[model samples]
Target: MTTLLEPVLSVRQVLTLERVLAGEPEVVAGAGQLDRPVRWVHVAEAADVGVMLSGGEMVLTTGVLLAGDDELQAEYIRSLHRAEAAAVVLGLGRAFPAPPDVMRRAAERCGLPMVVLHRPFPFAELTEEVQSRLVRRKFAAVSLSEAVRTALTGLITADAPLQRLLDEIAQHSGCPVVVTNLAHRVLATAGERPAVDDVLRDWERISRQAGRGEGDGWIRAELGGRGERWGGILLCGYRGDAATGRLLADRAAEALVLHRMLGGGSAHSWEEQSAQSLLTDLIGGVVPARQLLPRARAAGLPVNRRTFVPLVVRDGDPGRLDRILRLLGMPGLVAELTGRSTAVLLSLARDQDAEALAAHFAARLRTETAPGTVVAAADGRIAWDDVPAGLREAQHVAEAVADSAAVLDLPPVVRLRDVHLRGLIRLLRDDPQVQSFAERELHGLLREADEDLLSVLRTYLATGRNKSRTAQLHHVSRPALYRRLEAIRTRLGVDLDDFEQAASVHIALLAHDAQQR
Candidate 1:
């Protein structure tokens, strides 16, 4: 079985080894500093050997050169401290056969750990054992780093999605992986379902408290390029040393940055995709809503005991809608749907007025965006199971008004009641009987491909068959309009003066237009 390897050994861990324990080592000073990392083990006998050392090395000595001079012993300890050595192990056979107060006091003052072996121990055995272990660990760490790098690069080359990359990282780190924007909104996640959900349930608090470095088992690395930071990737609750976790996080960050640069997506695009996936699944209803409750919660949507308002906007921009939600301090999910429409699912408190909030959203959309933007909404639902039908109803309403929004005096938010006959036609547009009726009723004009007559008829019927209004709107004289209406009547074999005949043609035209859309 493969296990994670720590790159460096702490001084305390080094002392507990069986080979080092054979010497009966006892900590005489700086016991509180025993957790310091030891990079290597060195055996130096010279009194001024501190100059020949780098930091984090455990220096082993017999103290033979400083046996007679107390000042020299103190200076030696000070020199090792200045060199930033991890600790000093003194074999006390010839050098006073006991712990020296001068050196111990100096080490304690400098906060450098000092150990003394109380037996005849060979420094070579301890050094060989530790050195080999360190070498093996270092090699393992390098191997792990390379393994992660190769796996990530291979996935990138295969054109894997962002979630796949995160999953790969999570598998290697044995923890949940999260990608977030600068504001700490989680854009993507991968790992065990329950584990990822647990992380996301309290993500805001955790993100605020986590630094952009290793903390406990949480390691974070910035995801950006060209000297601009846009987001970050985190390894949450990793069960490994800081060094190993850091290596994993840094490698993952590099892969993520490259993925984004190689057209994986921007942070906003990733968020949009996430919303799209969830909303698509919700609307599709292939999976039951109860089965998707965990997903909704993990996506940062408040689902418990909240009123859900399902809305669809015709020709709406998802980005602008998301911004409006943020500006209003409303929690919602926005995503672009098919047919140039966008879906916005708002999670509101039970006390709030869903209709008013949806109207407010529509008002803001009209004010900040296009004045004719049509927002269609369904009745607010208090249960999660009702949301799918609500979304479908809103979509139906939006589609019903898509072609006639400019002419209809729709409220800020259009609902099913507001759509009337048009909504029914839209719902039945796909029916074979409706399609055949529309084709047969409009066959003459459709076959002619004369858009001028069709437009005149559409405007005339839309205006309650007001001939004067149709003539004026079409910029034609009454005589010319009469001739066109006569031509339309002759082609469709219907009487323009008869109300029932005109209504039948009007319904056919609406159904035809709906089908075309």
Candidate 2:
């Protein structure tokens, strides 16, 4: 069975000399000075005993050599003070009948704690007792460090998630554990007392403050692998001593780095993963922009210093896009969204134009996918905080472009304006009025046994009401096409020849298709 020692085993505890020595010790001087830590215990009878002490020691002596010599005793006390000893214990008996007045006055003036033993005390026994306790505390600290390392390493080897590892660390350390990217975004947290949000609510301020201090209440260690730093782990309100906290942080960091390294993929791939997660979150709009800053930076995104160009490519091959990105030496995150669409957060130089960049990506993507691929770039370059809005805009454009049919003059870089009518319809697809209008207009055709008449109308509208082309495309006689048109007009209560009416019906159709998609 293993037993845990007191968590706090500071050098200061040895100041309780009576308990340590098992004899009543008289405080001859410096009563208020006993608060200093006794790092070790040393016994000396030599006159120049101060030379042997490095400091933080409670020196014990019988004073057998300097009996009744005021000058030598005062000098000895002064030397101990100069050496920064914790306290001085004068063993009574042969040394003197009682504590010397001159040495006591000097000690009092110097504020060096002086204790006089009232009875004969075995110096060796005191040394053994204090040293044993100190040694036990050292071993206990080593045990705790090993215990923490083993627990975290075990979890890492078992394929535990990052949050689970942090949870274990927090459980052992009894404090909140936070993992963040270089940009200072909170990635995961565990054992957050009072709530995780409370710890992260002011992360910016807290991080800045913690950065300026040295192990005050918070401790941190960098998480790195493959010579590239991923981020860091932070512990708030750590209860252990500074040394132990550092050890724990180091072990946790090592485990975290190793876990990432062994999880499959390289640093570049992990960088993409990080970016993909951040971009997905931005598109989702679930997490705040400020919260994503650190992750963006740590993921090799210039969140602080560079402009971001949000881009989306629909119905394109992701592998081709990834290869193109690698060839261009552009670092960005690419995530496969729902369907055939993919989202990208491209980091651009501050002076680069979003249009030029988008055009470059579009040209390469179109070459890869061939025939056609809709590439939508956000209106302009934006700050990291504004990237989410850009993502939304780019996604809107991509969806609109995908639903469009007669975009004959396609620009390399499509935007909201490029999508025109189709863009507006896609945006409003979910609006109550749009849905009601689509249902009301297309209700008859939607209820048909077959979509023959619907296809005819679609071909006719797509051909700008050109009877010849519509009939030829549908492989039907002009009269047959006319009949289908008549059926459409009757069902929708509109004339296909009227421009305004045809435009309305076309928009409704586009919205219906977009909704289906």
Alpha-carbon runs more than 4 Å astray in model 2:
1-239, 242-270, 280-295, 304-306, 315-340, 381-385, 404-409, 444-502
Which window of 10 residues has the lowest lDDT sum in candidate 2? 1-10
In terms of lDDT, the best-performing candidate is 1
Best-matching candidate per TM-score:
1
RMSD for each model, in Å, please? 5.5, 8.0
Tell how far residue 126 is off in model 1, in angstroms: 4.3
Provide TM-scores for the models. 0.74, 0.60
lDDT of 2 by residue, 335-416 (tens): 7777878887788777777567778888877776755678888865566668889999998888876743332357887888
lDDT scores in order: 0.88, 0.75
TM-score of 2: 0.60
Candidate 1: stretches off by over 4 Å: 1-6, 11-35, 45-50, 60-82, 87-126, 137-161, 164-168, 212-214, 224-228, 258-265, 285-308, 326-331, 347-353, 368-371, 381-389, 424-517
